[model samples]
Target: MRVRIAVPATAANLGPGFDVLALALELQNEVEAERTGEAGISVDPGPGAPPELCDPARNLVVRAYTAACAELGAPADGVHIRCVNRIPFRRGLGSSAAAALGGTLVAAALNGAPWDEHSIIDFVSGLEGHPDNAAAALLGGLVVVTPGAPAVTMDVPEELCAVVFVPDLELETALARRVVAGAFTRADAVHNAARCALFIRAIATRDWPTLRWAMEDRWHQPPRSALYPAMPELIAGALEGGACGAALSGAGPAVIALVAGAPEAVQEGFMRAASRCDLRGRSFVSRVRNFGARVDLSA
Candidate 1:
C-alpha cells in the first residue's frame, strides 16, 4: 500500500499576530509513504531536501509516521518514504509543519483510520510545538490559533499576492525565540493586540491601505531585527515599491509583503532592499492557497 500527501508552505506570525496567526502559500512539499511489507525502512530524499531530513531517527516525517503507526495500530515494518521538497527548510516557512503533517496523514491512510482534521492538527502541532504553522498548512487560507484550543481559519482574498524575500541568512527558530524570550511589556502586548486585530480585520474587509499600519508589531520584530538586521530595509523597500503592508515572515530571515497591485513594483522594491542592505536573497510571489493538504491513495 502507498499513500501520497502534499502540504502547502505557510507563513506564520504574520506581522503582529505572533504565534497566533498564519496563512498558507501555494508552494508545497510532497511526501510518499509506502508499506512495502518488508522488515526494514528506506528513505528516498528528493531534490533540495535538507540533510537533516534524510535520517530516519531525526526525520520529522519518519518519526511522525512511526508515531502514528503506533497510535493507530498500523504495521510499521518495511516502510519506504520519499520526499519532494520545495519549501525552504528553517527559513520560517513551515517546512517542518508540512513534513510532520504529511507523514501523519500518509500513515493514517495506509492504516485505514478515518480522516480526522482535529486529530491531525493536534498531532502535527505537538510535533511542531506550535499551532499557527500546522493549522495553516492543514487548513489553508489564514488561520488564528489559540493555545490549548482548536484553530479558526478565514479565507484570504484571491486577488491578494504575497512577495516573499528569503535572505541568505538562516535563523533557527529556537535561537530566534531565545532572542525575544520573556521580552513582552504591557505596552508591547497592547500594541500587538491592537495591530493583530486590525490586520485580521483588514484582510477580511479587503482594506488594503489599512494593512500598512495594521501589520506593525513592536513585540518580536524589534528584538529579532538584531538577528535579521536587513529586515527593516527589506520591508521599507517593499512598501516603497508598492506593497500595502510588510513584515518579518516569522522568526524570520525571510520578509513577506502583501501586494494588492503591481507585483513588478514589489519585486523591484525587494531587489533594491537586498542591494542596499548588501543582503543576498530571492523573492517568491504566490497567492494565498485556500485549500491545504491533499492526499492520494493507491494499491
Candidate 2:
C-alpha cells in the first residue's frame, strides 16, 4: 500500500500575532510512503531536495511518519517515503511543519487509522514545539490558535495575496529566538496586543488601508532585525510598492508582504530593496490558501 499527501506552507506570527497567529500559503511539499519488505526505514529526498533531508532517522517526514505508525500500533520500520520538497527549509516558511503534517497524514492513510484534524494539529504542534505554524497548516487560511479551544479560522479573499522575499540564507529558529530578551516591557506588550487585534480586524473587515499600521510588531521582529539588518528596507520597499502590510516571515531572513492585487509591484519592491542592501535573494507571489493538508492519492 502507498499513500501520498500534500501540505501547505504557512507563515506564522503575521507581525504582532506572535506565536498565536498564522496563515497558509499555496506552496506545498508532497510525501509518498509505502510499506517495504525490508526491516528498515528508507527515505528518498526528491530532486532539488538537500542532502540534509535524506537522512532516514533524522528527516522530519520520516520521524513524523514513524511516530504515527507507532500510534497506530503498526511497525515503524519497513517503510519507504519519498519527499518532494517545494517549501524552502529553515527559511521560516513552515517547511518542517508541512513535512510533519504530510508524513503523519500519509501514515494514517496507509494504516487505515481513525484520525481527526484537530488531533492532527495537536500532534504536529507537539512535535514542532509551537502551535501557530502547524495550526495554520492543519486548518488553513488565517488562524488564531487558542488553548482548550478550536482555532479561529478565516477564509482569505481571492484578491489578496502574499509577496515573499527569500534571501540566499538560512536563519535558525533557535538562534533567532535567542536574541529576544526573556522579559517584555508593558508598553511593548500593549503595543503588540493592540496591533495584533487590529490586524485580525483589518483582515476580517477587508479594511486594507489599516493594515499599514495593523501589522506592526514589537515582540519578535524588532529584536530579530539585528540578524537581518536589511529587513527594514525590504518592508519599506514592499509598503512603498503598494502593499497593505509587510513583515518578517516567521523568524528571519525572509519577508512576506500582503497586497490587494497586482503583486508585480511588491515583487519588484522586494527585489529592488534586496539589491540595495546587497542581499542576494529571490522573490515570488503566492496566494493565501484556504485549504490545508489533504490526501492527494492512495493505493
Report the number of the highest-lDDT candidate.
Answer: 1
Screening candidate 2 with a backbone cut-off below 3 angstroms (N, C-alpha, C), the clashing residue pairs are none
RMSD of each: 1.2, 1.4
**Tens-digit per-residue lDDT, 121-155, candidate 2:** 88888888888899899888999998777777899
lDDT scores of the candidates, listed in order? 0.89, 0.87
TM-score per candidate, chains pooled: 0.97, 0.96
Structure candidate 1, residue pairs in collision? none
Clashing residue pair totals per candidate (backbone < 3 A): 0, 0
Q: What is the lDDT of residue 180 in candidate 2?
A: 72
Badly placed stretches (over 4 Å) of model 2 are 181-183
Q: What residue runs in model 1 are displaced by over 4 Å at the alpha carbon?
A: none
Tens-place lDDT per residue, model 1, 66-124, is: 88888888777798999999998889898889888988898888888886777788878
What TM value does model 1 have? 0.97
- 10 residues in a row with least lDDT, candidate 1: 45-54
What lDDT would candidate 2 get against the real structure?
A: 0.87
